[model samples]
Target: MKGLCTGLAAAAVFMATGCQASEPPTQVVYRFDDHRYLELKGWDCEGELWYTDTKQGVHSQIASQFYRIFTKKFVHPSERYIAIPWWGNITGGFSVSKDYGQTWETGGASMSPGENEPDGSNAPYYDDVLSFTVVNDQGFLQTKHRLYMSSKPFDDPRILPGGSGITYTASDGAVHHIKPTSSGPAWGLDYITKQGLKEDTAQFKTNYQGLPDKVPEVKGYTGWDHMRCDMGVGR
Candidate 1:
């Protein structure tokens, strides 16, 4: 019986240390700028603002500022436009800039501020507007914990189905899910969907910090121009 016990122990040891462990599932790496994220990247800090034009090799200066005050949280869907969730004040609503940053005009009153208003909505209801994205002409803005979307840019933004990791179809007829990423924007992550099989190249990690090592064949994009669509996947 003692010999039987010893043999069992030896078998257990072999099972524990004989073979290598499997690697973890490959997760997508997202790069974004959150108030907490800018520190991880290289930038010139000034007061509450951290400015950098060459973030990950992108020609854009991000003035990381506080949520309130005159600081504007803007999103540039294209080189010709810059959109903001709040124009100037809490009730200022949204705004947009067409000719670069040369000028900005109010878009609409999607968000308003007040106290104890009806409809269970008021100043603080839609406050804390953070990241904004334009997927196929449909505008989606992520707030403190909820997602508000609009059919058009700066139009009436309404709350979408709550909770993260929920899949939804965009106005462009494409499916998207706000999945986790290692890196985009200042949030250290952003939204993405399973884009189905790779056309070329075997499966590999696409971690470029912010600059792509090679320019992909994409339309309307000049090699590393700071314009990152689909995390610079070019698809």
Candidate 2:
């Protein structure tokens, strides 16, 4: 009887530990506003991107198998457009949304210039990308070779012509010229209020500290393990 009781107690403890171990760690990486934010759920630096919009009562996974180190999230000032550029060991792609976070489409633009061209001609090589930013509802990918800009309200971004300098017509029926030196449009995240930034920072710190020590095992072949994993916040 004593042995049976001991075995039962041990089983209960094992079950409890298993339950705790199964719960993957989660952290709020970036906050667009009080109502909208981006979270990471999985292991320490490898996970999926989950977008939450409290105002719309929407909580959905935007992208999967995201490595926090190489992935970045960009938002328009009005929160109407969001873009994510991610890279794996051998390949990389973009995931974009036009109507906020309602829906997401992957593989819109290519980091390699002219890859989208039908014949795959002109600058067929991959550009050494340095940074990506969104300004004036447009996405800009700065590379060591040249700067690539997308059209306004970037849902399906196509690399614009003329490299860093280009003249294009705005949706407002006005012709606008962008020079390499011109810097009128500011970063979309810059428009976020100070209070919002403060809250987001605090929340991130709290969530990060609470992450589990052991990374939960991901079942099945996700094909994302090759993605670069490092330590950093997804901006």
Candidate 3:
């Protein structure tokens, strides 16, 4: 296993080569960020946010460890647009940027304080307002955790089996239960037909920290940027 991991790490380091010949318009390659690698730090899980971008003719890759709810998360279908799920306050939310790494803007309703009411007693029901997943930017998957806009807001957000993996509350915008995946950590969304709502397919491990070696020790995102749609994966 150790030898195989060493080979794979060497292979990844090689594949990660040519990730970019020249930095995109408003982008910067990791090159060397001391606090690199994915690990469970912020909140109570381990993961990272990664994204790709392409503009005019140049291409670039972006990754970061920003924390919140679904913090360390980034997916891009086209090089032009990127779907980034960043954490905010101890609470949670998201933002969008257009002009490369120039700016970012948050959206959706604003909450007063972290979980619970201002007094920390009564709490409002929360659905999957921010429970989101993207498959290379083709389509986004979200479980029905809260029914924020209906009578049954955030009723069923897909039962996240075993707390050994990554799961999401969907209501108060929380992404918990995280396991490791080959590429990174198994923190994606899995759909359940019988349940009629997207289930939190992420499974939590008993050791939790005992993750797959390939998962990488990522704490959170360090920096971020977007690529073009035409410039998909690989150069």
- TM-score-wise, the better of 2 and 3 is 2
Q: How should the candidates be ordered by lDDT, best one leading?
A: 2, 1, 3
TM-scores of all candidate predictions against the true structure = 0.27, 0.53, 0.24
lDDT of 1 by residue, 115-140 (tens): 21333343323446564553333334
Q: Model 1 segments beyond 4 Å from truth?
A: 1-75, 86-90, 98-102, 106-109, 112-119, 122-130, 134-138, 144-146, 153-235
Local error of candidate 1 at 178, Å?
A: 36
Query: What tens-digit string does per-residue lDDT give for candidate 3 at 1-235?
Result: 9999999999888777645442232222221123221122222231233322332332222234443233323333222223344443313323333333233333411222222232332122233323333222121323233211101111122223332334545557876543333212112111121122222232222212222212122244333321112212122
**Which RMSD values do the candidates have, in order?**
22.5, 17.3, 20.7
Better of 2 and 3 by lDDT: 2
In the range 1-235, model 2's lDDT, one tens digit per residue, is 9999999999999999888877767777665556776777777666788878899887877777754644432333335666555554212445666667787754444333233223433221233545555444555554444444443331111112333544555556788655534422222211111122232221122111232222223233222222234353332
Best by TM-score: 2
Clashing pairs in 2: none
TM-score, cand. 2: 0.53
